[model samples]
Target chain A: MSDLEEYKTVIGLSFGNQNSSISFTKDGKTECLANEEGDRQIPAIFSYQGSEEYHGVQAYGQLVRNSHNTILNFRDMLGKSSEDVTDKKHKRSAKPISVNGQPGFSVTVVDPETGAETTSKKTVYEFTVRHLNRLFESARDFLGKKLDGCVIAVPSDFSEKQIEMLSKASKEAGVPAMQFVKESAAQILALMYSDSALVDKFVVVADFGATRSEVSVASIKSGIITILSNEQDLHLGGEQLTEVLVNFFAKEFEKKHKINPLTNRRAIAKLHAQCEITKRILSNNTTASAAIDSLVDGIDFHSNINRLRFELAGSSIFNKMSDLVVKAVKKAGLETVDINEVILAGGASHSPKLTSLMWSVFPEQTVIRSSASSATPLAVNPAELAAVGAGVQASLIAEFDADEIAGSLTPDVVNAPHLTKPIGINEGDNFVVVFDIETALPAQKSIECVAPAEGGAYIPIYEGERSIKVTTVEADADESDFSEEEEPEEIRERVVTPGTLLATVNIADVAPKAKVEVILHLDAEGKLTVTARPKDGKGSNVRGSN
Target chain B: MSAGKSIPLFPSKTAIEASFVPHAKVSKPVVRSVEPIGPYFLAHARRLKYGRTFSEDER
Candidate 1:
């Protein structure tokens, strides 16, 4: 073990509620590792049949036959009490029950020797430990070395209690959890570090996963990334989209056999599994088919659906996702025009329909990095982005002391106070921002402005708030008279509200067209100092601090 | 002084201050760049050592 220490092997783990992935960094490049079954996106599932146990894709396969014994989608139940899990509709898997007031699932265990079946209860925490152990073992087997440690990418909405439970589970599994990076931050880090030209841009990371969708706006300035606003819809995700296809196919089967597959639990489970595959296929092709043998009443089911129909079927959910992105941008106190880039992450983000819809939501100039975009830095596989980012983070901190890493993750250090609104100067009726919001402490900016053409200028330094102004443009009366009536167009313009006047500087007797240099420095203690001087040395210099 | 006239002055030695409260500051993590590793580096090293280029697949 001591001899192997020189290698410093570490892995990044992106553990989601529906699926999880593991990644490793080699030669400063990160890659997701496939499990023994050649699956990079491993299902977060476990199953028991008699004396045998199944995991990953095998466990997913058991959902159809052993729906009562297969446990899946339990990652989100961690750290929740039994009463907190109000959703008792276990259509595809084991029913969650209370085990000592904690969330647990009831499964039947069969004894091989006696052929006896007995019921057993397993808490979510125990399953999490086993899941982590399996992931670490698979990673170790692939790397052929003992792991130094690992960084886990978690959702930004995870509470302190959930994070603590996850940390404890990792400890129980004997996998060192070096750090917990926010999934959005991890995705941005992977992109920023891979491409050096992504600095000083406002990025929106739309992570559409299987069970939930998370959208966050982040500002990356000088290599430091800060999340400006975050929005999450727990009920919206890939499963919802799959359900649309499942319903469509179920209707098609009903039309043929006069039987509804949704009436049977087993049939629904089978349709769900098949529809998930069909959905993934539709992401790559314009049309896809779903087939299931012995789907219902000893009948085989086969159907085909085109991408246009599938997208139309799922249009409501897609629109909701776009609305979520708009809400995130609005919450960040920004307009769509202010966003520089949108980085798509998570498995569900691979849908071409969703990618194209993003163009309508953001400005035409915004660069969206996805499989459908022709951007220079093409989107990394949305499924493996967070894991790759975690891997990169793991490699960076693998050699650091554990205590040092812990100290850096404390709330005080992570949530250090930053500027909530931008500080800028008022030029006539326009406000030109000099220092952006969320800038780290002790920052400075210098700008050279020309004095007014006719007289000296009064520069008022103020804190600015961003807002959107909407105006409606009526349709042309001649065009409407000849053609069908058209809906009025609403144009949204970004408006800045400069309310808080911080300071004002007056310069007298400045020559026309002369340059006046203004320097603003903000110290670590939040002290602001402004210095202005005329380049021609003809006007009076003014200096002030706040 | 007349109402239309203004006085021109030189740059002041003392700086003017404003009333603004600063939030408490905290230390941030120091992110260090890790040295590159893996097949590409190994191939480069082999080429330098043996005076021949080695394909990444050879590893």
Candidate 2:
């Protein structure tokens, strides 16, 4: 700790898709670190105006006039491949593009000297690296010295590759000692510091952000918090609700003026900005009015929408969210009665409808807790909760004894499976386990499987519990299987299983391969990868990328 | 600790102010670079509270 004391200029950062924040501890108190704008939360926005690149709130002001040059919400696309996003429609103002075979965005900017517009393609990774570099530089300037490293809070569902990318970006920013802090765990730490009563409780935590929502059930006992289950909807969040509002207002404007504002990019961008403001205003007021001057072709658009109308328009999304909550609770294997409290933490948690829905869902829980300060009567602004909590976690790491901080801030798993799914190899009538449940993480095992005598070996690897679906092969069942009485084909009536056929190991050779060694490796983050090799070493074998 | 020629890292008053002044004016008085309560001192003081013997690798 004496050597650790020499490098104490690290900051805690919460890099969000729509907004970002930083905080640091000084004189035994954690405070939100302000950006160049002197604001606690900076808009996670950036743009290239002429030849100069701008970031944070400064870039947000360029959205209206230079919408094409501004990039926002790139964080949501991180760790995704170009093909995964090619078919989906983007709702953001920035134009999504395949940048050199990667999922990225194209920004068209005018050259400052020539006054000619040119388009540049940037991957989400590149933008993120630039943003982090700028953030680190600002922190260094503010501290008036070099920093040790910073701790970043990330979504629970963020993949290992995404974390890897973030660390890579931090290194590009010249901050090399960075570590990840789970966002939910950081929030739990903040609560523990403020309130001691939460120690012995089963709490459901919901972090509703701009582009997605993650729900988890956590058990806290003796000041240690453990995540029981985590679930998320990647496509649902406050942005969806804002889209609903934008579409509603656009339709209303179109109906009266015989012109659709959505067709115009600038009009849609301006309307989006207004819709966001109206959405926040509607949270407190029964009715909110939206007006955009020269919204489309010199036509002014104005509409007054009430809370009921807004909620009704977004009811389907709300229902989907309710279903997600139910799914999460079911996965956690806990009934509503067993939940001791509901903890909502995020910018979108301020919505009355969301809060009321949680209350209705968990009626047994008398008090709904949030990341509010228990010492002070006033609630901690929901947007700053993750940042504040991350700041505390960083403080613990920097100053407290490693033993005391490690167990509380980082999860202490006892016999936790590396994969969420139960993995087994096919054995004639049933599947046999290479690694059993409660195997603790980062486990590896090899199983010898034989190839069929004549042809290629088809060794099936299955995940999750096996169940047989024996539908009687009755005559003329195709149309009957598509009965209106049953669920729509898209939504399967029953979960088909032999568990999931995760992979089928096969030899690509013309002849049969014998005595194949199928190796499975499960990493620390509960993710699996596979490698297969034949004992004879004559044929190519199939493998699964992690 | 040998005597050597010294040069200011921040030569201008404006540069010094920009380096030390926080983006937002905190309710607490801002610490000046010349003061004992600079960023280095403040962070150093906080680190001492844990009261642990440190290893070189721990740094």
Candidate 3:
């Protein structure tokens, strides 16, 4: 066995709507390799010249050309309703999606065994896992050896339930265990690792990728980093930067080549990619040039963009993010003086315009613009920052070499089951006023309201999504869900009071989407008694003694 | 004691059966006389006589 294969290497996987990548780490140093042939990325591009499957770097290289059939950026569909995706990923969309069915983007996958066609409706979670699993095999092949545990990077907004599904997929991939790390957190760790000196102070790490531009404020205290707030997006990133470059090349072509290259998808795909790389290089450099297209018989097209002018062309893009940075700074409760450093971390964060903008924004602070740590450095090419963080998380997993690992952390890490205190507030349609806490009383008050449903009623006292908007308090008022049998000829007058709340029982919004029960009691002497129990009536309730 | 007591309005079981149960037997055909009833319906009636029976002793 090779020395590199002697020690089992952990793999870090990052799957996104726009891109996917994997990194292998050994002895703590990571090499972010291209996941081609479905190794952390898609190699199969379905088109006329048979099926062109470009693995890893090649797949990324063919992104714009095969974007018509290449499905990326369905990351948002991980645990969401289908209605949310049809509006976005509709080109290769073969079927109408809905939330009630399985979640995520619907994609076509031909069974290898039978060659039968099938549309696999994978939830965002499923798609991410499937991609990760496919990448693992490719990674294993690349390594020419058996695989080890994995560290999977999850979106910052992914809830625990989605994490649970990801963990299950990893288990099926024969990865003994997996760890969940946030993209921003991993990127932050990767940046800190690559650029050594930024550990002393609070820095603003900006990430710009194909889909979105996000800014986050974080502080590294004694090498232990803390992310203060969630990421902010201006909805502008390298994709727009590429689009800007494409438009520039298109407009310049009409001026110089006298032909529109946008008419052909393949030709446009090849050139748009060249433009995307040129735009990224212009972020930090003076100028970059690329061949545009061919005109009449012998003429070849070339375009050169100056850094200063290209920045001007995408000025609105930079301007859109200015407020977001200010907002993030405000939310972080840090002033420009308080910000000791600024580090660029994403693909577009390498843009010279953005770098100069960062320098201008924080003239008082030290700004470190390092290229090594940016996640998708150039052309969204090989970068291991997210993968490195995932590897670090994987190393922390207890089952590095265990033959039979016990109690996989993957399940608990992603979907830690929690029991919400069953919200047991008496929630029959009738207001069963056991004791009104609203009444300012030395002596407690008790009033009984009618049953919600007419009949010898059964009230469940439901436990989720309940918040009562108290328009005005009614001291002696009862207006609730009507039952046909509870009909009285005349409506009773209700006296309205200030601060009287109309309460509906509901559950706490958390993983498990739990139901809670709140049981309050009143002593004959008018002291309030309380008990908190589970929705299943299996636990003790909280009692208010005083 | 008053809540727990069971009523025994009729004096004897034989007299009650002769008066009420036999009358039900006699009026059974009379009640069905209004309908175009089938004999198979009588084969599987609500109160059966031939098989395993239930009594107060069983209760």
- Winning candidate number (lDDT): 1
The most accurate candidate by DockQ is: 1
**Tens-place lDDT digits, model 2, residues A445-471:** 556665555635555556645233435
Misplaced by over 4 Å in model 2 are A1-7, A86-89, A109-118, A370-378, A399-546, B1-59
The pairs that clash in candidate 1 are A27-B37, A545-B18
- Cα lDDT for residue A253, model 2? 89
Stretches of candidate 3 off by over 4 Å are: A1-9, A34-55, A60-67, A86-127, A142-144, A191-200, A255-270, A281-285, A294-300, A372-383, A398-546, B1-59
DockQ of each: 0.03, 0.01, 0.01
Q: What TM-score would you give candidate 3 relative to the actual structure?
A: 0.55
Which predicted model would earn the best TM-score? 1
Question: Which lDDT tens digits does candidate 1 get at residues B1-59?
Answer: 00111222223222233222222222222222111221222232333335452222235
By TM-score, rank the candidates, best first. 1, 2, 3
Chain A TM-score, cand. 2: 0.70
lDDT of 1 by residue, A1-546 (tens): 686467678899999987899999888788899989999999999999878899999998998888889898887888988898855335578888999999998878889999898888889999999999999999999999888788899988788898899999988887888888888888887777767632456889999998889999987543557688899998889999999999999999999999999999999999999999999999889999889999999999988999999999999999988899999999987789889899888889878888889888876778988865655335578888889888888887787677766655544334434566677776335667666666644445567766665656456677777777888989777777765758776777766766577777767556666777777766545567777888788878777676
Task: Give the C-alpha miss distance for residue A351 in model 3, angstroms.
Answer: 1.6
All candidates: interface RMSD: 14.7, 28.3, 33.7
Local accuracy of candidate 3 as per-residue lDDT tens digits, A229-253: 5565625666777777877877787
In order, candidate lDDTs are 0.77, 0.64, 0.48
